[model samples]
Target chain A: MIDMFRRRFISVMVILLLIISGCNNRQETSSTNEAGDQVITIRAQTFGDEQTRIQNLEEAAKELNEQLKAENKKIQVKLETSSFDGSWEEYRRQFILAFKSKNEPDIFLTGHEDIAWLAKGDYILPLDELKDSEAYRDVYPTLWESVTWNGHIWGALQDTEARPIFYRKDVLKQLGWTDEEIESLPEKVKNGEFTVDDMTRVAKEAIDQGLVQWGILHRPVNGPEFHMIAKNFGAQLYDPKEDKLVFDKEAILESLRYFESLTQKEKVTPESMTSMEWKNVHQMMIDGKALFWYGGIWNIFNYMDQGAEFDYLMENFGFTLVPATEKGGTPMTLSHPIVHTVSSQTVHPDLVIRLLELVAKPEYQAKHSVETFHLPIHERGSEVEQFKNDEFLSQITYMLDYTTFLPNHADFNKYGDAYFNAIQSVEIGKKTPEEALKDMEVQIQNDLGDTIIIK
Target chain B: MKKWVLPYLMLTPFLLLVLLFFVTPVVITTIMAFTNMDYSMEWNFIGLQNFEKIVSDPNFSQIVFNTFIYVGFTLLINVFFALLLALLSSYYIPFEQSGLFFRALWMLPRITPPVVYVLLWLWIFDASEYGLLNTLTSFFFSNDPIAWLIDHPMTAIILVNGMVGASFGMIIFSSAIQSIPRDLFKAAQVDGASEWSVFKDIILPSIKWPIMFVTVWQLLSLLTSYEYILLLTDGGPVFESEVWPLYSYHKAFKNLEFGYGSALSLILVIIAILLTGVLLKLFKFNRMIQSSRIE
Candidate 1:
């Protein structure tokens, strides 16, 4: 009996060991086979609730494979990806963890804001020395600024979009504005003839006249939109020469005051605006309860998906850059571009770069634009039929001329975070503008230390 | 020698598990607390700089206050409701066998996935008129839609967390209440004692151990848990609901300050240990561990 039990126990132990080891042997990276030809697997990743960018990347790979086939090249590229849900913070955290473990994909897409962090950490390969081609030149020159850091181009511009103010023309008409006056509104704002103050006054008048339930609405969370208003108030977040972020107290204070007045004094915006969920904000705009909404170009597509008809939007809603802080001040909009970056640890940097080139082409980028509602990355992309045929894209193309991007400094987010917190404090009626500005200065000083120059 | 060898061999699996899951992570985290490891993963030993920064930081006091409020109030709600429900279902309404049904119903929140649970709460408290609460209130009270989350972020988080947590204590306390001898309660009832008197005299004494266990367990759990809050408030609207664990999370993951975050977590560990000691003393743990009466 003892001998039989021992044998049974050993058999069970061996089976258990096999079961445990089997769990670790799930799958290996699949590679194509040829007699002697080279094969490269190019893994790429990006995160978004939408899959347009991933589709665009796959199409680019297919296009590259076709070209290689025509040339009889043996190089075969395979792409793998994980598209994250809407939480960018969680997405970034995952990327950082992957980067730390050296498990990052060969090529990845992220916002320009992460360029400094990624570059400084040497997690990404600098693309400055890559051979320049006519294809690279096809991209807009200003867009190059977004990809450059410390005299090195660390990323290729994947996509760009403008944050603009969308207004209801029907509400303006209800407020007793004529059709010609409504048509001239965008031009007036573009020329700085109508300032933010005038815009606020119009919204307040509409609210008072009961033309709309709410005068205006904006993004409920912290983002690059606030940067545009800061720039309009003459805040420069980066000092390129010193290679440090800047905190212009006066300009930031002015921006804070403007937001405070909108929520508290002017009462144009809801005091609890910043705490709202993104869905609520989108639903509000789709329902057309507000006279004007501060949103991104991508928000138009989101509203449509949420059941707002395109024709209804075309007839009622108009878009423009955020107006200047004062009359005759230069109007500006903010663009936070997502860029394709090659990882430093990639086994196939050249193949990755080739894939990036294919992805950055005007035709593919225009497809990305039309599908995702993100603006195109290249000049020729605007000429593509898919992009040109879209009236909203054509109309909002003017915003690109006056666009400014968030600073590409690692510590810039630290400053930007502090600025946003101050804005929230003011909007929620928790702190005065003066108090919020003081708190922001202290926070910036404490967080950035000597890295930021306060002027 | 064979006897010792066999016993050690029998314990090997459990020892390996303890080392892998508990001991290894603790050692690594302790070591990491002294290093300036960030997004680059370079472990530069920065000594106590991170700790010093945290101690001297202005937001430290606010974080402490938020942690205290979140823990204190959540524990109160969990304990009070759990004890009440335990008594009602186990004794007061035991005849109908509805106690089991009610306990299972309460456990639904605990069993329901946290993401789905928090999402339900978000929809219920959604600031828009389309939300469940707003729709109900507007129909009944003829009031504008109220932004429940932004207006009462702390209260919202406490209630959500407490509701889920109450089920944990309920299960424990109910079982403890059942374990009490029936003779004590029957004798009290025969002597013309009221229901409240029987509970205070007999039931409360028998369930002391469970109550203490639930209190300390929930206190420690609440001190560490930021998931529900993170999903709900995200410590936002100007850090009104930012708890210690959530703050550490933001510092480490969001700000990429791993060293500072590790130090913060280490501080949390120290606080948890100290609080455990205090709770043990308050509960007279040594006395409670002894048998209360001879069989």
Candidate 2:
């Protein structure tokens, strides 16, 4: 019996060993056989779920290879691109893990918010020489602010979107506003004539009159929308001189107070609004249950997919920057731009930048802009016929002129996450603004230590 | 000599595996706990700093409290529902083979992929009239759809975790109940004893080992498990539902503070081991190692 058991165990162990070893044989073989031909394989990863970014990458490789073949350089560039459909948090988590393993992509596409961490970790390469290229000048100058860290240009702007405060003109009209008044709402907001308090009052009136089911709706989850609201209250999240995250106590308190008042005081928003899923928030606004929705320009495309026509949207909805906290204050919107960076481990930095140059061309950017509904990064690209004829793009492109990006700090996530929790506590009536603000300060201080300035 | 050498050689794989997968990681984690390793992967010796940070933070207390509530309630619900369902199906149910069908149905939530399972729960608790619970509640009670996750996040998470966990114990208890000798049950019944007495005397004692086995196994699992809770709530509504393991994950992966996260995980491992010891002592594990009562 002992002998039989031993034989069985030995065979089973051998089979398991073979099975486990087989799983590790996944590395691709290099094609180095041809006598005078060299292949530079570039592996790239994009956070975008859309295939357009990958297609653009492949096109750059194909274009580069064709030029190289014409020059008889005997070199070919192969670009392998992978796109992620998971949440941005998951993508960042996976990328960080891969970077730690030294198994990262040669070129990585990530949000500009990741620049501080990636640069600080020395995981990415700085593109100082690219500053002299036309490809660098092709993008809007202000967008470079997002990708700059420690006085170095760390990434190329891949794409951007401007978040807008969308309001239903029909709801305002139903509340007995004049047609001219509805038409001038964007300008009113632009000149700070329509302040946040004015928005709250209007939402309240709409609610009282039953013109809309909800007064004002924003994103349910933690996102850049909170930054837009904070900016309206004159809050700056980062101080460049000190190179530290700014926790301006008064500004954060005011912002938290405003958000709390929206739900608990003015009753413009649902108490459960903070807990809502992303889709329900979108569905409510598109279904016209909201008087004002703080959303992105991409929401127009989403509404179109939800069966709303452009004409109908133009007739019923008006878009503007989120209003300032007070009259005559500067009105601003938020822009979250994704950027492309070369890995420090990459061998072909020149070819990578060359690929980014192809991607930044006006024609290529316009194609991406039209397909993805993202704003054109190139200033002259907006003049292209495809971009010029798009009424939505034309109208909201002015937001680019006054947009603010999130602070590029490694600890920005910690700071923003704590602030989000503070606002959530206030929104849910679990804590007052005073209490929540104190809690937020303590949380940030604990998480970020003295790296953050709590003024 | 050949027989002895062959047996030792056959045992080598299991011993090597334990060293490679389990012991190696624990050793590395202990080493990492003392270093200020993060996203940069620079192993700077920062002795006691990570532990000091964890102990000094106020949120640490709340996180511990939340973890206890989550594990305690979830364990109670898992064991209660599992044992109750097993008893009902085995003895009370009128049909002969229907008990197996009911037990299989209970396993459905366990068999489903965790992500898909949590997503289905998200839809059910969606905070809008479109959600299933909201639609049903609005029709019956004339009340708006409640944000189940927000209003009762602890309950929502406990229920989500408990419902899936109950199936594990239910299957174990069912088999243990079926293993009770038919003669023992019939002899008790012939003595004019009530069904309750027969169950109390014959069924309960026979399945004590399975009950202990499932309890200890589930306690260890629930103490470390955070998947359903992570997916369902992501420890949201302002850290109200954040447990230790999920908090450690967020610290290490999301915040890129791997040193702090490693310290947190080491603490979790120690706590899990301590709890397992207490449970072993409580369950009289030595009694299990002794000869069987039937013999």
Candidate 3:
């Protein structure tokens, strides 16, 4: 009887302990050290290949701490940083889960396109107070438009890059193109003198002449590049008056038909191009096996990291805007600007904003741009010597004039997925462009419900 | 009441754990299926709307068909192939250590991390002249490089998942075969039973319970698993290799349609329960649990 009582007692104790642990919700926002100084630890996370997004914040923390000391404040800010170099979808999902769990970082860097979703989810703070600050005075007006959603500024623009159609000049030369023609291609594309059909014809000729094995290569995965192509074909992505995403069927059909012709009719691009790895795509471009690559300016740094000399890249490769869909049509590029957002769960909102302001300085932004090969968010960054002297950066900066942005609608991801799935279907010969577009319409309507305008 | 207290105390911890991990999530998911939760994560209930959307989805039929094919074929490979290997190593093979080595070789896929295993498959089937399969085809048959994953997504995923899944059944079946009394085999041989006859009447009967367990277990597992498929094909080239679980995940996490994803998951749970019930009846699980005739 005594042993039985002891067993019951132990079981009760285990249950009580578990319940106590489950109820423990201790969260340390700040701590005081033995010196009686308040040490504030601010955690920050940034996604994708731009490590400078968070690294620059760490540097800014130092400046902020010194400024605090100058103001006779008793606080020292310690910034802890983490980066995820994976797909943006996975990164955003992680952040959303973190927010739901109430353990989100004080600051996170993501695409400006996610502003609407993040703001709606209440995962980020509205930095409308910082909009009039002196630090943001020099930022480009267009970039400011990107970080604003629902009449409030949601995040601070970090950096942007132009998506360009990169081509191998040597391949064009081998196919009997003159140096003059090679140099004039960008100008021709910009002015709509060169159409997408003409680009396809050229790619097909290169393949026929055995100068290149493949005509054009694109990102194997879904990305802003597809939306850029859709916009080039005249798809209006958003209805601002209605505040709904637009599914422009005619324009999307044209874009899907274009991809179909490239894979099915032209026979220059492989049917399995969508399944290839990003590394393989880069290797094909570097090895000159492909004539044109629908890529981004950041790829220049990627190529350099892969051991291709900058001089070699300049001599061998050339970049131009995505050609017009038809004669006398407008040429275009896309800018997916990364933005730094303060989490709503943060205990140090003011300190986080101050650190972000320091990180946004022209000198620091320019340094990050020069190191990462991304374009600066403001005009003053152009005055920085490093950004001013970069030949590639100087050249690509003009493309931003014709640049477009993905819609800031919360349901834009669903629309983008439908668009990418249509492209994949057409390229794989699983469906005609018409069928793919019809299927996409159904998918979009099903996913977005009344949130999207199916035109 | 006093007599029941000790047993209840012993069972308390396990019941609490089940309540915490299993019951709570299921209850939450059932409730979420009726909500319109999206990126905002709000639980705004809209009854049957998500289910209506699922029924109206254009890819619904194709996704269902793909899941059927994936689960059906993978279950076959997981059960029969595993049984074959177990029989060869434990009963048929003359050399014991060689059999053990062969079993270990099959276990490698199960032991390797899913990412590394998928990476190896990717390297082998890459749609380029440099891929291992393409290289071999080029060298031996002088053939052009074939896009293996894109052209045959179902086959690639089924084989990858099946190879890993078979190892689990292999371990279980091998143990069951080894536990059979040695004297029965000797008696069968003395009675002039041929090797094939011995396998048919004696060995097969002895391992019936193991076979039944493996079949039902692998079927349930295959219905829910999509990691290998996600890593390999991502349910693409179209929805060719996409299964139900992957579709649920894409809807929930990828599209941020948490409520709809929950609805999809709830349907999958119902289907799994029905399938399990049918399988258990077909296997005569009640009979298997009854006392053996000899005892």
Candidate 4:
């Protein structure tokens, strides 16, 4: 009896110990140090190539701390920043999981498109109170639409980029195009004189003449660039009043047809192009093996990182908006703005907003923009010397005038997946454009139900 | 009660581990399947809507078909190739260390990180003119580069997965083959039996249990495994290579439909149970587990 009692007691104690250890004690967000200084630690995170997005917040904290010290306040602020270099899907999933667990950082950076989902989920705090703040007054009015959902602003714009179709000038030259014609391509695209079909024709001709090994190379994965191309083909992505995503069937069909022609009919893009590695695609472009790359302005940095000198890129490549789908139609570019959001679980919402405002200041924005090769969020950012003096920034800034944004809807990812799958099906000859479109319609309707408008 | 205490105490750690890792996740997943959980992470109960969605999914049939093909063909390669290697290394090879050397070489793919392993395959089958395969073809035949992955996604995934999977079976079968008594082989030689007849009559019956274990084990592994497929084809060039588990993963994590994803996974669990039962019965598991009549 004594031995049995001892065994039972030990088992109970072990179980109780496990339970105690498994339960976490929430840490105090702010603490007082021995020096009588109240220390506030704010954790921040950003994803992808946006390290400067969080680093700028760290810099802003330094300035804010100095001001507090000057004002004789007993408070000190410390910013804990992390930048993830993984894919956006993984990053967003981590943030969502962290939020669900009540362990999310005080502030984080994400694409503006995520604002709708985050706001709907109540995972983030609304910044409507800052709508009239002086810090946000100079922000470009167009970018404001991207962060607003359900009549409330949820985040501050961190940075923006324009997706451009980069072309190899040397390949065009080898195909008997004169320097004057090559230099005028962007202007022609901007004025709607050059069409997407014309671009395909040129690529095909280049492939036929053996001037380039392949005609066009695109990202081998699903991304916002496909949406930009679809927009050029006249796909209406969202309805603001209804707050619903639109399928725009005919326009999507045209987009699929375009990809099919490129990969199958024209034979300009490889059927295996969708399965290629990202690094190889960039290398192909850098080697001038491809006549065109449906890529982004940020790729300029990627090229430089891969040993392609800035001068060489400038001398060998030309970039323009995705050309018009038809003659006399508008060319389009896409800007996927990354934004700074405050978690709803934050203890210091006001301080977080203040830090974000400091980070949003024109000079800080210009510095980040110049270093990362992304465009500024406001006109004043261009006035800063770093942005003003950069030749590439100056040249690419005009593309923003024609830029479009992905719809800020919670289910936009579903639409994008269906859209991309259809493109793949068409490109690989598994289905015709009509069949792929039919499949896409069935898929979106089943997945999203009444949340989407199929036209 | 005193007698029972020690045994229960001894079993406590393993039972606690099972409760923590296995039971908790299964319970949570089962509960989640009934809720309309999404990126919002809300627990609003929605009953069978998720299961209904799975049944109605257009890709459901195609994914199921892909899963069967992947498991079936990969299992064939894994089991047969492993049996061949085990027999050769343990029985036929003149020098044992050389056989061990070849076995160790085969084990490299199993030990390499999945990402690195998949990357090597990607380089080998790259569609571009500069890919390793393409470089060789261009050098020897002066032919244009062929798109190995795009043209034949299923074959690539099967071979990649099979190569890694075969090593596991080889290890199990080799040990089993090595354990068979030398008296059986010497007896067969004294009876003037040919090597092929001896293999058929002695070796085949000696390792029946291991063969059955490998088949059932590999079938279950293949049914659930998707990391290699995820890295290699990501179920694409279209849905030509998509499997059920990958589809479930893409739905839950990629598409952020947690509830629906849970439902898909729950269905997979059910299918796995049924298939496991059938496999065990087909392999005569009860008979194999029974004590030998000779003993």
- TM-score winner: 4
Residues A1-455 of candidate 3 have per-residue lDDT tens digits of 75877777787878889876655432477888676779899988988666677678888999999999889788989888899887777888888877776767888888898989898888899999777988888776777777878789999888988999999999999998999999999999988899999999999999999898899888888889999988988999998677799999999999998899999999878888888877777888998999999999999888888788999999999989999988878888999998989998898899999998899888888888988989998888877888999988888888877888988888888888788889998998989999999899888888777888878
Per-model CA lDDT versus the true structure:
0.84, 0.85, 0.88, 0.88
Candidates sorted by TM-score, best first: 4, 3, 2, 1
**Highest lDDT against the true fold, candidate:** 4
DockQ of all models, two decimals each:
0.44, 0.48, 0.59, 0.67
TM-score of chain B of each: 0.96, 0.95, 0.97, 0.96
TM (B chain), model 2: 0.95
- In order of DockQ, best first, we have 4, 3, 2, 1
> What CAPRI class is candidate 1?
acceptable
Q: Which numbered prediction scores highest in DockQ against the true structure?
A: 4
The predicted structure with the larger lDDT, 1 or 4, is 4
Clashing pairs in 2: none
Put down candidate 1 lDDT per residue, B224-293, tens digits, no spaces.
Answer: 8899999898887678899999999988877887888888998998899999999999999998888683
Model 1, runs deviating above 4 Å: A1-36, A129-131, B292-295
The lDDT-based order of candidates, best leading, equals 4, 3, 2, 1
Cα lDDT of candidate 3 equals 0.88
Q: Model 2: per-residue lDDT, tens digit, B1-295?
A: 4568777776788998998899999998888888878778788989999999999876899899999999999988888889898888876776858987898889899999999999999999988777889989999998977888888999999999899989998888888887777788778778888988877877777777877787778888887778898888889889999999999888887787888889999999999999888888887888866957332
Model 4 ranges with Cα > 4 A deviation: A1-25, B293-295
- Residue lDDT tens for model 1, A1-455: 44565576577678868986765452233466674445566778887865878887899899888887778887666778667676766677777777655667777788888888899888899997543755677676777788888888999888899988899998898889999999898899888898889889999998898777777888787778888888989998898778899889899889999999899998988887876778878887777678888789998788888888889888988887889887887888888889888888787787788888877778887888888888887788999998999988888887888888888888776777788889999988889999999988877777777999889
Q: Select the stronger candidate by DockQ from 1 and 2.
A: 2
